[model samples]
Target: MGFINDLAAKFTFRPGRGRKEQNGLLAEELAALAKKIERLAREQYKANILAEQSISMIHEQRAGLREEIRAGAIRELAMGLAGDLLPIIDGILACLDFAGENESLRAGLRSVLDRAEVALARYGITPIEALGGKFNPSLHNAVEVVEVSDLPPEIVLKEITRGYRLGEAVIRYSEVAVSKSQTGTVWPGME
Candidate 1:
């Protein structure tokens, strides 16, 4: 009986040692679980930041696209308006030339010109100064060359037709008479 009891006692687990070992294992497992949770939390934070950045980029792209669309619409509108006004301006200039020395007719023509200028100014349109200025091929179409002793060669002496610009864009180029030196070097396009 004593031998059997001794063997049973040897094989049986003691509460104190078992509880201590179980507690140690539980603590290790809890620590590992805490580390895993912290890692997951950090990953979640990084993912959130990435999502926010993506959203911001999308918003900026959308805004840029909207601005481009608006600018295109404005450009189209300005072109159409300028095209409509060109013929009217030419007619007014013709009338002014034909008014001659009649004071009343000249006054009326000047008033019309003023109104036209106001309308053009509303859309950023303005005339390019050609007469008495240096001839620029980009702004002026040289229709004729006049012999001039006072002015330098290539200087614009007269404007046959006025030129206009809308925000740095030439809507029309001036038909101009350029000065030629007495030497008659034969300006370009003249045989």
Candidate 2:
């Protein structure tokens, strides 16, 4: 009977005792809910940080691609412009070549050529000097060599083809006739 009574007491509730027990259960449930809320807040903060980082990385990649595209376009335009100017340079050189055999028209052709050169100069183009100057393998290609007693050796005696430059870049090398030493001894350096 005592065992039976203890069992009954475990299931049975006194009025005040039952109310306090129910309130304690509610408090425990609320504490558990607060812990879940804190975990959700931490997760939200991490997701926001990751999203910001991803946005920043994408922005940097887009900027780099844009800069590369701009540079490539600029390079292509510059190359095309240079190709177009090559034909003009060739035409001027051809005129100079034909002028050599015609003495009567040479002066008039020279005036026209000079005007063209001046116009090119206005746009940053110029001809390289070859005749009677020191031999520079960088800007002059020797097609023939002549031995002259009066002229200094290694001097440019004639220009076969005119060479040109744009800014500091050489477009063509001048085909020239360079002089060799006549006496078989190296000529003294020129003054």
Candidate 3:
């Protein structure tokens, strides 16, 4: 009996409501469902666009990191190669000091040295200023201390071999003689 009543209720309509009213209620429900579907589609589209923007940002950051790594590697390689080449360059300079009575040989060697300098110059390699200047532990390596009464202590007396730098970085320190007083104290009238 209970099942029969439930089945009758489903098939029957209200006392006053006709087919038109029932159809109106169904149409309202369909419109609400369609609106919900459209809203959800718009939200999904926005999410996809945000994801694409994030992916591109990540790609740009990765490219920047790669470029930084490459630049660092090249800097290290240039420093190492300069280390090996410096000894040879110093040797050539030493030979030039004793290149007397061989004018042609000396001139040829000078030209070769100049070319080598030009090649390294392309990479921003340059000689450090050492002689007749104040001594700096960062740029100058004190190979010998000269005892003098006239010059101020810590002043560079001589440069034994030239130093080199790449930009602000010291590739090699200048071998130099720094001044010191005979009594191992600060010079008189010198600050």
Candidate 4:
């Protein structure tokens, strides 16, 4: 019976408990809930800011990629036009050789060729160095091999037709005559 009475007392509310105290406890619980909600809101705001920054960075990268592609296309077009003009320029040069006695015709041909060269310069097209320089398979295509005793073998003796380049890319390889030493002076420095 004593155990049963103790259990009953635990379940019952004491007479000292008042509505004022219950209201204070409820207010404290509500304040704690409000603090938790504020913290969550601040975290959500920071996440949104980070997401916006990521999106902006992605947009900038995409724009840069587009610019690079456009520039590459322009470069290719200019190179193609320059290649087509080279044959005409070479023909004008060949005419100068035949115009030995005709000074007026030679001068006129030279002027026309000079104007064409100036136009090519606007697009950064330039001729490759070949004559009197060491032969490079990439820049010069050997059209003839001449036997010489003084100069080193593989040296470019003459440029038959001019080669051209746009920056690092070769538009056409120069047709050239390369030298072959007859006396077997293979190493210039050794002598």
TM per candidate: 0.66, 0.51, 0.64, 0.64
Q: After superposing candidate 1, which stretches have Cα over 4 Å from the reference?
A: 1-51, 184-191
| Top-scoring candidate (lDDT) | 4
Candidate 1 differs from the real structure by a C-alpha RMSD in angstroms, to one decimal, of: 11.3
- Model 1 clashing residue pairs (backbone): none
| lDDT scores in order | 0.84, 0.76, 0.85, 0.85
Best by TM-score: 1
Report the lDDT of model 2 for residue 162.
76
Q: If ranked by TM-score, best first, what sequence of candidates would result?
A: 1, 4, 3, 2
Better of 1 and 4 by TM-score: 1
Candidate 3, position 187, lDDT: 62
Per-residue CA lDDT of model 3 for 68-99, tens digit only, reads 99989888778877877888888887788789
Task: Tell me the deviation in Å of residue 56 in model 3.
Answer: 4.1
Where does model 4 exceed 4 Å of error?
1-54, 101-103, 183-187
RMSD of each: 11.3, 11.0, 7.8, 10.1
Per-residue lDDT of candidate 2, residues 1-191 (tens digit): 67446545654665666777866865776687689779999999999999999999999999999999986775555445545664665676577677777876777767777776786666566789998899999999999999888777888998877777767777678889999877766555532
Q: Kindly give the stretch of ten consecutive residues in candidate 3 with the minimal lDDT sum.
A: 2-11
